[model samples]
Target: MSAAASSPASPAALTSSSRLAWLDALRGIGALAVVAEHMLPWFVPSLRPYWFSLGVYGIFVFFLVSGYIIPASLERHGDVRAFWISRFFRLYPLYLAIIVLVLALAWWVPVREAVVRDGSAVAAHATMLLDVVGIGGVADTMWTLSYEMVFYLVVTALFLTRGHERSGTWAIVFAVAAVLVGLVASGAVFGGGWPAYVSCAVFVLGLTGVVLGRLRTVSACLLGVMAVACLLLSSRVPWLGAAVLAVMFAGTAIYRWERGTGPLWPVAVTAALVVVAPVWAIESGWWWVRADVWLTTIALAAATFAGGMALRGRRLPRVLVWFGLISYSLYLVHHPLLKYFVQVSGDLRQAALPYQLLMTAVALAVIIGASALTYRFVEKPMQDLGRRVSRRCRGGLQGGGEARVPGEDAGDDRVLGHQERQVPHGVGDHVGQGDTVG
Candidate 1:
């Protein structure tokens, strides 16, 4: 055997895998929660729990992680163009692949009714603003991508505006907006396909401007406005979308406090406001959004994240970390895979308990196995290429790097085992699996 394989892992190798093992552990847990959330209903309804939506809880965990780590991904590299490049390759390839997969399988597994066929779906998806624009995702879980993309746009703009440090302020702003919109808005305020159409154009144009270095700030600003506008005017519930964004920024605020660059109070305020945003929304009917249930889910998700942070220095289980590496794929592929199973195998809910358990095991194994393969073949290669491309553009966007704090290194790409690029890939709250899949 080679010496490299014979000896114990070097300190550097251990550091690479163990430093952010906690984050990966969280990702793995959240993805599995979502998978179980979707899977139990189809294969074994009796096994499904009714307290808090597993999907919602899992999504919240994901949002928190993304909020915490994304800024570091941007600042560590210190470049706007490269940041976007890395993000694009991180998400879009898998995202587009899922879309194609869904369409091709649409004949076997019926597409969700909310998915528009009038070209609007394509437009909404182009911006990853599918749910916010009143269009359905190719996969139900993809609605979360809209908000993820929005957060990225807003963060990019803030980084360029020298306002990146004001994470708490933005968190509060969105929290307040969520409540205000929840009170006054009813259903989607922006109707028709125009919002998707217009936003798609802006999305493309803004991204181009940001990348090419011509009026990049203005471009980012436009993208930011487009993002916020879609959230307020086009989401299924105005407050829900706003509150989700608030959760992401609240994650950022907490991160700032950890870096000693900010105070801890903003997180408290944002949390309070987000808790209240959907309580009295005009569209509030779902039992899951009841103030009590929502609070419980949010609190639990927060606690899970805190627990992970507390354990950050310790070596986590290797299986969990591997699950995290394939989490994005697991999250995206599981729902469609479930749909196909239901369609082909018929509902297993009536099957004997032993048979149901056996089927669930087989289905989960298939989902995890497929996810691992995709992560290896697709996500890993693209992420590697993106990092290389980003390295060449080091020092960051000509204007954006100034906002990154001096002497405050947020992450080590190698030390984190390339998990930084995986931040945006988790969770989408399409009201969980019982209602919708995303």
Candidate 2:
């Protein structure tokens, strides 16, 4: 027998998987796009029409990446407790800190007088459950987190039921059905705030397809084309935004195909074209010039795919990596922080361009500083704590499985062994069971 057959995986195997530098780089770039999208007015008047529109695409990219990576990680550990703990530690601490900081700023800072006067908004933001209330303008950006939280709960439920033959498939189908039903029920594709949740489900299914190795090259390419067309249509008919929404998942499929061929240069060129296509269409007065909005959408999808491919195996500088790591916090805090500063600084939006730039810069500085500190103290610690707690809980479940029931005798060993072997895969390593068999 080969030596490899003699050695079983030990616990150290947990951290053995090589880090994918490309994902990190993709994240870093995504974070920057988000920052630029939020801070667009500081640079150019021409961007005003496109800034928020393009900025949203950046957030979508972040979600797509999450769907891809989070499932992949869960597949590896095969321990639900460890997975939940890790997620908690990674998210809650920084999240809580941001909430507290926002509250303090609203209450104590003279600049936040207007915000404090209407403190109900601050209460909603602090709970991290604002999305359910349909209350906007507080932590307005935490809207995405609502989707993220839902996804997490769904994934956890799936993990618990991993042994079920058709759970994964049903989940994906149900999610897609939800989006369609939502679209139809809302009487608009993307307008009604509730319809956006469909995107979250679509994203989950798309990534689920990738993890399960069920995605087809032809279908992915076709989906890509459809998505591109939908993006163009979205500008005119917003409800069809679901089409544009499909691009992220379609891009994930394409990224897998590109990885197989190693011809990233061609992919990069194609991505650039995808980005510039809408812009050109708009400039040429193609009767669909308004569709230039899709340029940013398609470009970002392609860039994320290409950048993800390029970032493979390479460690980016710490600064870029740091941005990627704290991107969520940045996204959450930047807007509120900016609004507060603008209000305090007095008529920031009304100010001259230079003054606008200065105010924006100062706000960004505060955001960065606060985010960094939050990441260190809150996000990191909470993530660690969550992981530890999850592991302990999962370990107890595992122990019960293996610890022989008193006086049960060793004859029941086969059942215990089967249970041990059948645990859900880790968050990182498990091949997504096709949605059909989760």
Superposed by TM-score, candidate 1 places the C-alpha of residue 438 at a distance from the truth, in angstroms, of 10
TM-score, cand. 2: 0.58
Compared with the true structure, all predictions reach lDDT values of 0.77, 0.42
Q: Tens-digit lDDT track for model 2 on 185-287?
A: 3322233333223333343454343223344222223323333322222222222223223332233333323323112233343333333333333443433
Residues 118-223 of candidate 1 have per-residue lDDT tens digits of: 9888899888888788888878788878878889999999888888878899999999998888788877987889888988999999999998788999999999
Compute each candidate's TM-score over C-alphas: 0.90, 0.58
Clashes of each: 7, 30
Error of 1 at 137 (Å): 0.9
Q: List residue ranges in candidate 2 displaced over 4 A.
A: 1-20, 42-52, 105-137, 163-183, 187-291, 315-317, 398-438
